[model samples]
Target: MSLPENFNGWEHLQKTYMLEYNRRVDKFFSDVQGNGDLSNVRSSLKLACRLVDGDNEATWSLRTSLFFDVIGYSRKNLSIFYGSNIDTALPVAGHPQLFLYFSQDSQAVPLNGKRLDHEKSCRLTRYACKSGQSLPAVTKANLLDIAHEIKAQFVSGGKGIIYTAGKLSVSYTDPANGFPKGTRWLVNSKSEAIELYGKLCNVIDRPFDINKMNVNTPEKDSTTQVINTTDTILGKQYKQYAYRPVANLRFRYAYVSFGGSASPIFLIDTTFRNTALIA
Candidate 1:
C-alpha cells in the first residue's frame, strides 16, 4: 500500500507533533543538504534511526496521536525496530548517531537511503580494519574502496557515493573517513575532526601511520595532554567572560562515523549556596 500523503520521509517526524513540524522538517532537510551534521534528519526518516536516537517518547506520541490519517506506516502490521545492545554485528549505534540495535533475533534490516550511506561508511572502516586494536586514519577515496568491498550491504552503494563539502578548501582522498589516505591518525574531538578534510589535502601524498591519525584515540593511551579551553576545545579557560561561570558550557567531540558528537559540561556538578557569604 502507498504511504499516507502527509506521513512521509522527513514529512512527519513524530506522530503527535504540531502541524507546523512538517514545515520545520522540510526546511531542516533542505538546509541540511549543504554540510555539517544532519544527524537529526536521520532520526526522522526511519524507525531504526529514531530508536537509536533514544526517542522513546516519540513512540508513545505516535501511537496515541499520529493516527493513520497522517502516517499509515506508523500504524501498519509491520513491527517497528530500534536496535539494542545484544546486536553485535550491527554497530553499537546506528551509523551517524551511534545507535545500538536492541532485538534478540535477526529480522529484515532497514535498508533506507541514509542507512545505506552509513553502511558504506562502516564497510570501508571495517575493511581497513587492520591488526591494530586502535582506530586508523582514512581518506574519502580509500573509504570508497572499503565501501566497494561491501557494496551490497548499502542500498544505494551502486547508485552513488557520499560527499563532504566545506569552505576551508578542505579535501581528502578517503574523504569518507574525513582523514587523508595513508595518514596515521586518531579522532579525539570535533575540532580536530573539522580539520580532517583540510589536513588530508596538506598530506596529499605523504605516507603515514593510520593509528597516529585517530581523532579521538590518544597517543599511546597515556597521552593525557589536557585540552585547554583557551587554546583548544577541552580547555576550561575558554569560558572567560562570554558565559557566566554558573551557566553550563557546551562540550563537543567528533566521532569517526558520526559527524558531530556533543555533550553539556555543566559549570558545577554540585551546587552549594551560602547566603552568609554574600554581603
Candidate 2:
C-alpha cells in the first residue's frame, strides 16, 4: 500500500494503531480476571521482561508498575473471574509453556510407636509449540481459547493446574476442573489495586473536596461542591465513590522464533514415586 501523495491526515494510521492497542488492553484484563494473585502475573511478566532485557532494572520496575495499573483495570471490569494460581515463569529454553501440580503425602513415624511425616510433591509439565507447521493461530479474539486449551490438554479435568501468558486468562474456568475458591483470593491483599483507581482522579488533577462526600451515597444536604476551573460553577455538588478503572495495556510475545517453524515448543515433566529398594 502506498500513502496518498497529497494526504496530510494521520487519522487513518492512528485508528489502525488504536485498534491493536485496544485489543491488547482487552486481552490483558480478560486473562488476569480471576481470583488469583496479581503477583503471579506480575512475577511472570517480570521474569519474562528480564529474560528479554536483563540489565535494566529501573526500566523493568517502571514498566511493571505501569502493568500493575493495567491489572487493576482488568479486575474492575470483571470482578467475578477468579485470578490464576498456577506458578508461572519465563518459558524454559525451547519451551513455549509450563504446567504444574502439587500432591501431599503422609507417613507413620517409627520413633514414638507411631509415624507422622508430611511431604508435598510437585509435578511439572512443559508444552512446546515452537516447532511444526500446524501451529494454531494466536490472536486477540482467540487468546482466551488458547489459554483454555492449555488447561484442557495439561490439566484435563484433574487437580492439575497450569500457568499461561496471562492474556485472556479470564476465560480459563471450569466448575469441576479448576482451583478452589479461596485459592485465588485478592481484594484483601491488593490495596494498591484499589488505590490506583483513586490515583486516576488525582493524577488527572480532578479537584474534588474530601470532606463533603459519603461513600454510601451523599444526600443533597451533605453534598460538597467541586471546582474544576476558576470560572466554572462552584455550586456543582460532587460525591466521591470508588469505582474501578479500565486499564490501557499492551500484550507482548515472549516466545523464540526460528527458521520456518512457528509453533510454540512443549515440555512435559512427570513425577513418579521412587520405590526401588537398594540391593
Candidate 3:
C-alpha cells in the first residue's frame, strides 16, 4: 500500500499530548456516541491498517493518524453535538464561565492522576425556585427520598444526587453503605427538582402531588385521585419526568483500552487510498 506524502509513521506523541488529546476526544465520544470509550473505532483503524500492511512503517503511521483524526473530529465538534443545545459537560452552576486550560509545552502534563484539564470552574446558582426567590418547602426527608428513588431508577449503575440547599449542601448517600459518591449526578439540587416538578405541572396543566410520586408511599385515597388523573395529565408528566429529557451529569475522562499496548491517541488516516492525491 502506498502512503501519502505528508504521512509519517506513528509520530510518537509525547506522553502529555497523548494523554490530554485522548482525554478530550474520549469525553466528546462518550457524550455524543452514547459510549464513553471508542474501542471499536480504534480497533477498526488498527485492523484496517493491519489488513493493508501493519509491518510497513508508512502504513502503521497512516492508520495511526487516521485513528486520531476520527477522535479529533469528535473533539472539535464537542460543543456542537450534545444532548441539548443549552447543555454542557461542565456543571452549569457556579462558574458560569468555564475554560479548559492545558500546558503550552504539550509534553509537560502527565497522563496519570488528576490533571489540570479536569479542573472545572463554575459558580453554582445557589438554591432557588424558578421565581428566583426561595427554595420550595420540600422536606429534607422527601427530598432525600426523591433522590434515592431517582438514583435507584438506574439499576445498571448507581449515581449520586448533588443537592444544594441554602448554605448547606447534601448529596444522596448510598442507602446500603451511606456514602455520597458515584459515577454521575454532579449537578443537581432539590430546588431545581422542585422547579422541574412545577414546570412539569404547568406544562401539563395539572397539579403535581408529591405523594403520587413513585418515591412516595402509596396512599389509597391519593392513589385513587391520582389514578383518575393518571391516563391524561398526570401520566404524561410522570413519563416526561421519569423517562424523557431527564438531566444527567457528564464527566470527562481519558479513554483506555484493556491492551494498554497502543497509544490512546488517534489521527486521520493519510494513506493514498484514503486521501486525494496532491497535484
Candidate 4:
C-alpha cells in the first residue's frame, strides 16, 4: 500500500506502517502454511521494497525492522548457528544446511582446513546453500532472494518448519502499582510494542531502560525487585527504605530450541517483573 500523503505525526505514520507490516507478515505465513508457495511472499517483498525505497527515517526503520523480522523467523524456526568460526567441512546428509554464517574477506574456512572463496560471504547476513547455489549478500535489494533461500533450505525439503501464531503475548506490571499484580496486553506489531512502552513510561514518569529489565527465557526463570529510600537528618541521621514501582520486561520463546516443551502454553511471552514479558 502507498503511504498516505497526509498523515498525523511520526507515531501515526509508524502505526499505519506497522498495520500494513503486520498484515504482510500474517499473509506471508498464511501463504506458506496454505500451500507452501512463495509467490505472494515475493510480491509482498517487492511491495516492501517500494514502501522503503526512499531514504528517510520511516523507510529506514521499516527496512531494519523487516530484516530483524526475517532474522527472528530464522532463529525461531531453523536450526542455525552464528559465529565467526563455524565448522562447515562435515556435511550431514539429509540434515538442514546451516544457511546462515559469518566469514571474513568473503572467505569461509571449512573443517577440512580449506579456505573457500565466496563473493557473498558477509559478516553476519550472508546466505549460502549448496555449492553453486549461493544468494547474493544480504541487503535491501536482495531481501527477497535471501528470504526465498531461507524458505527453500529451511522451511521446505522436510526440514521441520516450525510455526507460531506470530503474536507477542505481553504482560507488564502497572508502574503505578507493584509487581505480582499488573496487566497483560497482546502485541501483534512493533508499533503496538512502542505504544505499550510509551504507556509504561508515562505511568512511571521516566523512560523505561530495557537493559535494566530481567529476562526469563524458556530455559530459565528469573525475578526482580524495586526499592525506594528516604532520609532525614536532624540532630542525627535516619533513613527509610520502602518498595517503589519498578517494572522489568521479560521474554520467553516457545521453540524447542529454547528449551520449550512439546506443548507450549504460549508461542512467546513478554512479561514484567514476575510477569511474562514480550518477545
Show how many residue pairs clash in every candidate, following the order shown.
37, 26, 18, 6
Model number with the top lDDT:
4
Q: Local distance difference test, per candidate? A: 0.28, 0.28, 0.28, 0.32
TM-score of 3: 0.21
Q: Alpha-carbon error at 35 in model 2, in Å?
A: 20
Root-mean-square deviation per candidate = 22.1, 25.4, 20.0, 23.4
Q: Report how far residue 33 has shifted in candidate 3, in Å.
A: 19
Over the full model, what C-alpha lDDT does candidate 4 score relative to the true structure? 0.32
Whole-structure CA lDDT of model 2: 0.28
Candidate numbers sorted by TM-score from highest down: 3, 2, 1, 4
77-114: candidate 4 lDDT, tens digit per residue: 33333323443332212111112211111112222232
Per-candidate TM-score against the hidden true structure: 0.18, 0.20, 0.21, 0.17
Q: Give candidate 1's error at residue 92 in angstroms.
A: 25
Structure candidate 4, residue pairs in collision: 269-277, 270-276, 270-277, 270-278, 271-276, 271-277
What tens digits encode model 1's per-residue C-alpha lDDT throughout 1-279?
Answer: 988777676525544353444433333233234222435533334222122233466664563343332534234323333334363443322222211111111111222211111111111233233333344534445433433322222113122122221111211234343332433322333354344333222222233333333343323332112222343466544522211111111111111232223221111100111111111
Off by over 4 Å in 4: 1-65, 68-75, 80-247, 255-279
Of candidate 4, the 10-residue stretch with the lowest lDDT total is 116-125
